[model samples]
Target: MSRKRLYLRAGLYAEGRSDYDFLLPLLNRLLSSLASSLFPGACDVEDSLGIDAPYPAPSERAERIAAAIADRRAECTLFVIHADGAGDPRYARQSCLDPGIDAARRASPDVVTVPCVPVRETEAWLLVDAEVFRPWLGSDAHSALPAEPEREADPKLTLGRLLKVKEGRMRRKPERLYRLFGEEVSLEALRALPAFQLFEAELVEAIRAVARSQGWPR
Candidate 1:
């Protein structure tokens, strides 16, 4: 197979550390997954704000990114972002969704942007992949996981509760989820989630369009 390479400049602005961390590795894996099979080759991501870098304020993120990209302060031809939908998807987009999209476009008219919101929380993506969670929750607590995770009001709460259940106690620690989703979860399983689907579709199409514009063959 002939592989095409995109000198991609990726920019990311996320709501929190966990999502920031989860978003980077997950995105790399996802890009690789899509590239090797779906497209011609690989997308090498370049972002001045490293994948593990700190995030800007949610409100100013779009404005900052637009300025950065325009000035080459942040170098990326494309931007991938993650911000919580927080209990309302409506507010989530207003806060960052439209702005992020607009900023990337303004920065580089052709730059492709994919901004993701986890509905209520990023933890919800983990639940879409049952097999991954089935192991983490163990056999005993496996039954406790929801069949339709997106329906749960606070999937993050369910994740925390499930972890606590495994240890035979309840605790409000967010680090556990941070570790589980960051370290052990599978991206392939995450493909089942609607959020992931939106991300994947947008990202793939962006690459394809960019490739066509750059005249790269698949």
Candidate 2:
């Protein structure tokens, strides 16, 4: 049986971390779980961001990622997932998603660019496989990390019904208060919040769509 190699790029902020650190693990868990659950012999997914190199420009980033996909030398598909609408000059001046898709198509024409709905919405994608990652929170998931939150309330209140309860009850919901709290909240915020369940479901469906398009190996 010929094995296809799948390559993924986690984008700029994810550079120096091990797969166990951040988004990589979340994505890996989803893909591996899906593959194991549905297809025992599907293509093996590998991340090439481990190359220990400087961050490339948008086009260069696409090229470098494309080169890695090409080097796999197997019938494969490459998916590049990134955060869009970050107010980055490059993404604003030129379409990062389009160029990436074009670059990957240069190799397989099947390459996919799965940009987050928006920069802020990236929290949704990062948390797509969060259920499997709660253990990493260690002890209290709420206090996994401490910050000087602008709001006096426990930051975890941002999670779901609590958010409504806290903000809705506030006599004066300060704009700065909400914005500052948002900055401190991690991707875990989405996982713990009920409002984002739909986003998480969308990510799972998108991933499954890609996998299915690739022809899941039975």
> Residues 1-218, candidate 2, lDDT per residue (tens digit)?
86764332333222223221434444554445444554456446554232222344334655654554454425333343443334342463256445544665687765444433233323222333323234343344444332322221322233322223343553224443233333333445445543234435545554555666656432
Q: Count the backbone clashes (under 3 Å) in each candidate.
A: 1, 0
Q: lDDT per model, in order?
A: 0.63, 0.40
How far does residue 120 in candidate 2 sit from its true spot (Å)? 4.5
In candidate 2 the C-alpha lDDT for residue 50 amounts to 24
Error of 2 at 211 (Å): 5.0
